[model samples]
Target: MQLIRAFLVALMLCAPAAARDLDGIRQSGQLIVCANKNAMPISGIGDRPGFQMEIAQEIAKELGVRLSVEWIWAGYQARYTDCDLMLGVARDPKPASFLRYLQALTDVQVILVFAGPPRDVAFEDLSDKVVAVPSASLAHFKLLEIGADPRVAYKSEVAILQAIESGELDAGVVSSVALDWYRHDRPGAALFALSTDILDVTSHYPLTIALRHTDALDEADYHEIAAKMRDDGRLQAILARYGQTLSAEFDNPYARVPDEISEPDSVSVRKDIVEELEDLARRNREELEQSAK
Candidate 1:
């Protein structure tokens, strides 16, 4: 009897963590999401809710679980959190670090210029020009690398655009996603004005949904659900607002992942990066003209 008791205790001690499956989530009735704080247009803090939060809410609705967000900056210890999901995660393979990626969410790119500029503002062409850049953004680094004159710093992408509109800055560089949010919210903004000039430089990359698996067991089934959404074009609709349409190739990194686990989707593989932004701007302009009637 003592030997049997010892065996049972060992079995209990050796038990593995649980996998987040359909039935498990149904029983819990809650899906906790972890998101980076202040990532505007994706995940925001305080009053402004990012679109990724909306995406998480929709995922919870699909899973029949109540949605909740656990906000954290980069270095939050995962051992202390109960977060089961995350959205808009950059596809990095450096280290799993206790997280599993389910599927690619959308593409991300930097848009250098908006409409109304007299000339195209390329990085090599910034002589005698005042360019507004969101502090610490990819564009900011690139501007410095090219030795741009008078690089004005702004707190946020929205602030950069506002400075341009207020005539405090001649032009600004911002991410396509934030610009998409701005055009959607303020469709009547001064894109129709003649001052918005074109700046040169554009690129894109993929963003994925990161999963904090409760278990190390392969999550093929959970991934299938996200794949279903991608195949049905539902995900495309969400990304299209920001001029991001998923690549038709669907080069899924989650499948057949090797042991190395590096930034598989490292560089922005997008070819027609600026064209997508222009198309969005053109469509919005036409809609604005119609609404003016």
Candidate 2:
């Protein structure tokens, strides 16, 4: 028994991860997706169909497999579990363990008001007006910074919309992606009368779709999915359903380049400029030296 235990320990020390690749998962006829079970508009296993679930379904269709979700809580395995893809994660270190650069998902922080927007309404303009912000969200912090009297409410986007319709909150904030679903389930022209796109969120975060290093997909693939959704009028229709346009970042993706692409280009361009400047400086120095001689 002791010898067997020692051998197992040696094996564990030798090989930590087994090979879980795309071809094998595809052959199994299921694309196992790891998703947040409670996050709204993004993903959750409930009444409101999540956008991440829709994305997963599309990917499964693209790969010719069935979609299966593996709901995760605090700690299990985002990588080694019954999941090959993790959806709707923020730009954080949690997905850094995986080996892929996610250049797709568009995210932004903005606030919406239930009433018809006043021309050029500012934070001070909302000071006297009752406003509701999602607790602990970027909007909540922004509202606090602006010193607006904010009433923090539901964490769910749909619930937030319901609260707005029920005259509970004068205004509320949520991820634009989640708003897509809200606009769909509830149809009303007066629901979203104001979108505070002018909000400054230079330090805001974005949601991402993370995949294993060996996974067979790229940013272009996701783009194609979005393009199809747009062409078929499914995605845009959902946005219009709420009288809300796409968030600034998503209205045009190229407006915000991915760090993976932009970082390298910036480095290369700066290197070229530095090299040219150095050569010019050297030539000028040589000319001055010859003149002194």
The candidate that wins on lDDT is: 1
Pairs of residues clashing in candidate 1: 93-261, 93-262, 116-196, 117-196, 117-197, 121-200
Model 2 clashing residue pairs (backbone): none
Q: Which segments of candidate 2 are over 4 A away from where they belong?
A: 1-19, 37-40, 46-48, 72-82, 89-109, 116-120, 128-130, 145-153, 193-208, 215-293
lDDT (CA) per prediction: 0.59, 0.57
Model 1 residue 200 distance off true place after TM-score fit, in angstroms: 11
- After TM-score superposition, the amount by which residue 52's alpha carbon in candidate 1 deviates from its true location, in angstroms, is 2.5
lDDT tens digits, residues 1-293, model 1?
Answer: 68855654544433323336556677889988777665666777766566567667667776778987777654233324567776666655453555776665655556554346345444456644567765554556666766774455465677777666677766676666666667776776663222123333344555666777634444565566667766787666665554445644355664322334232433433313433444555565566578789
Q: Which ten residues in a row have the lowest lDDT in candidate 1?
A: 192-201
Error of 1 at 60 (Å): 1.5
lDDT of 2 by residue, 1-293 (tens): 68855654443333213324667767899878777776666677666446656666776787788988877752234533657677765544323344443444555445465644345566556655556665565556767776676776555566766776777777766556655556665545356534665444323355555665444455455556666765676654544543334334443433443443223323455446544655655665576578789
Q: When superposed on Cα atoms, how far off is each prediction in RMSD?
A: 18.0, 14.5
